[model samples]
Target: MESLIAALTLVVVGYIAGSVKIINEGNEGIVERLGQYRRSLKPGLNFVIPVFDTVLVETTREQVLDTDPQQAITRDNVPLTVDAVMYWKILDVQKAYYGVEDLESALTNLVVTALRGEIGQMDLRETVSGRNKINQALLHQLDEATESWGVKIMRVEVQEIAPSKTMLESLELERAAESKRKAAMSETESMVESIQRISRALQGQPNSQAVLQYLVAQKYVEANLKLSESDNSKIIFMDPKALTETIGELISTDQAELGNGNGNNL
Candidate 1:
């Protein structure tokens, strides 16, 4: 009789042991009875049915999920290796427990899908420069998609948006070409401004015909220097006879002096 009483007491103690639970702060627990969600347990002491209700899942703290670098393509077909970090937390423990299988994995795929989708809509340059905007947009989209999982996305950070080696080289080449083009444009503008000033200074010269001849001669000298050395460069050939005839019609003595020496080096 004593042995039987001891056995019964042990069974009773075990049952009571399974009936109560204690959840730590910043954490929550999900209770399930016979394979179905019964209730959620908040932090601290909680009571439940001895053997029927089981603590199915416990997760309440904020989670940080670092995404592996995902190979993605931009709208302009530039390939990128992108990675990100996500901040999230469980809002409904019961839903979190039953809503998805492999919660972290599902969330990860969700994040990657969202990331690729957003990146696909942008060019590679925009993805690199507008990282903050991308992060916020990702957070918003994630929050919406994760609601079914009873998860809230607090924030997202784009850790890196690395371009392919080819892309980097291409960008460098583009920058070089752009710089050279700007320099050429600046030189052209300066030349034009110089010509304008020379014309204005000669506006009231003794003979307008001589002044025009001198200006044309100056332009011929300037054009020769500005011509490109490249094999494919174009040259606008002008007839020397036509030019000389035009200058020969000038009768002013100043024009004669210009023809003799003043215009020779110009």
Candidate 2:
């Protein structure tokens, strides 16, 4: 009799212990009684009926979901691939357990659907440049959708937006062509301004020969300096005094012509 009593007591103790659950920190347990949700067990030592009560769900403190790159068409009719990641946390254990059949699958589908919708409304350039705006939009949409499911969307981040290599090359070539066109325009404008200035200077000159001789002398001096500094330079012997006297004579003749015209007018 003593042996039978001891065995029965041990069985009872084992059953009770198995029914009692200890939820770890940063975790929650959902209890179901007779196939129906009874209550959620918070982190600590808790007890339930041995045979009728069961743990319906267990949820983590936090969760992360990385979405694969998805190909989408933009509003401007450009195709692009976008990858993203999401952070979520379970807020209500009961809702998490019963609100959706599979949380991960639901979340994945929701993310893809939201991304496609947002991308479809934006052009490729806008999608790439306005990534933060897109992320915020996705997070808001996801949070609203997952509210009933007890999953709170903490953040959504766009990881990457990849354009085709051919598109990238085409963009680069267009930019290069634009830069070349601008450079050519600038050079042409500078040449036109130089010609205008030279024409104005020649128009007012009373002695064209004297001005031309002066310019020639200046150029000759510059060339002589450069040639003297170079290796294997030729020695061109030009009389500097004769050059100055010729310039003086040309200036005097121009002054005489001007004086004669003034006297006739008077």
Candidate 3:
């Protein structure tokens, strides 16, 4: 009778130990009885049949997925490299487990495919300027697609968008060329405006011819100085006084023609 009592006590203790389960906070467990899902276990103390029930525990907390940099192309045919991060939470662990074979891998691939698709619809400039727009669009797309997966897409963030090295170099060169063209145009416009002002100031002056000669000589000297500063410049010898006289004669002829036209109009 003593041996039988001892055996019964040991069996009771073993059953109690196996049936009692303590689940920590922020986690959940699914109970499968006889190879079929029976119930879900919540946080804190829970009970399950030890020998027949199997529990799989997973976190309920939010998770982060960092997608690797993926190659993509913009609408303007610019090849670029891009990557993003996604924030998600599992709403239904059963769906998360049974809905997909490999949850993480499926999510990653989905993100990569969506990222490339979004980028392909925008130009490089648009992609760079509208990163926030891109993120929102991705979030919407992912939310809709992940509904059946029992996953909540909290937010999608584009980490980086970088053009290829060759594209970057080409953009730099194009920008530099544009700058030079603009500078040249501005310089030419300023010179033309200055010349018009000078012509107006000298129109009714007595020593207008002398003033014009002096201005022409000054400009000739400045041109020579600029040429001398250039390493590849070839020195060309010319008579400054002769060149100034020729330009002054040309100016006089133009003024005379303008005066005749005005008189005719009057």
Candidate 4:
């Protein structure tokens, strides 16, 4: 009789021990009865139906995951190394537990495919400059894809976008070439504006003959200065006094013609 009573007592204690469950903060536990989901257990102490009920799933926490870098080629035929991060949380524990097998792996592959598809549609320059666009697109695509899995995508961000070494060098060279082209264009505009200003002074301003003579004298000085600085340096034999006299004579003739209304209009 004593042996029978002791066996019953041990069984009772075992039942009590197996039935009690303590879920930590930020955790959830789902109870399964005979391989079927029965009920979900929230944080804190909970009681189950001893040997009949099993803990099926016990997590609903947010998670951060870093995706491995994958190589993708852009529409411009430039290859890129890309990696990203995802912020996710379980919204429905039942669906998260049963809707997918190997949830993390599936999500990772989906992210990579979506990233490659979006990036492949763009050229190298757009892919680099449109990173935010890519981020938004990824978040949108993932949110839709993960809805059935009971996961909510909080955010998706592109962590890195590295191009091949040769591609990077080519991009640098192209940027440098563009810079030089813009600089040349700006200089040409400046030169044109200077010529326009000089033409206006000679055509429409007072003492236009004096302006013309001054411009000719300036050119004479510049030409002689360049000749003096040649690789085979030699003295330029042009007389400054004679040059000045020649300018004076030209100005006098132009002024006399203007006074008689016979000066050239330009």
Which candidate number would show the highest TM-score if scored against the true structure? 3
Predicted candidate 3 versus true structure: per-residue lDDT over 26-140, tens digit per residue: 8888999999999888999999999999989978899999999999999999999999999998888888877899989999999999999999999989999999999999999
Error of 1 at 214 (Å): 18
lDDT of 2 at 65: 97
TM-score of 1: 0.67
Show model 3 residue runs off by greater than 4 Å.
190-257, 264-266
Give the candidate number with the greatest lDDT: 3
TM-score, candidate 3, is 0.76
| Global Cα RMSD, each model | 7.5, 11.5, 5.2, 9.1
The reply for model 1, stretches above 4 Å from the true place, is: 180-266
What ranking emerges by TM-score with the best candidate at the front? 3, 2, 1, 4
Regions of candidate 4 where Cα sits further than 4 Å from its true position:
175-263
**Positional deviation of 131 in candidate 3, in angstroms?**
1.6
lDDT values, one for every candidate: 0.81, 0.81, 0.86, 0.81
The digit string of per-residue lDDT tens for model 2 on 14-98 reads 9988878998888898888889888889888999888889875476667899999898888987777889899999998888888
Which consecutive 10 residues in model 4 have the weakest lDDT in total? 192-201
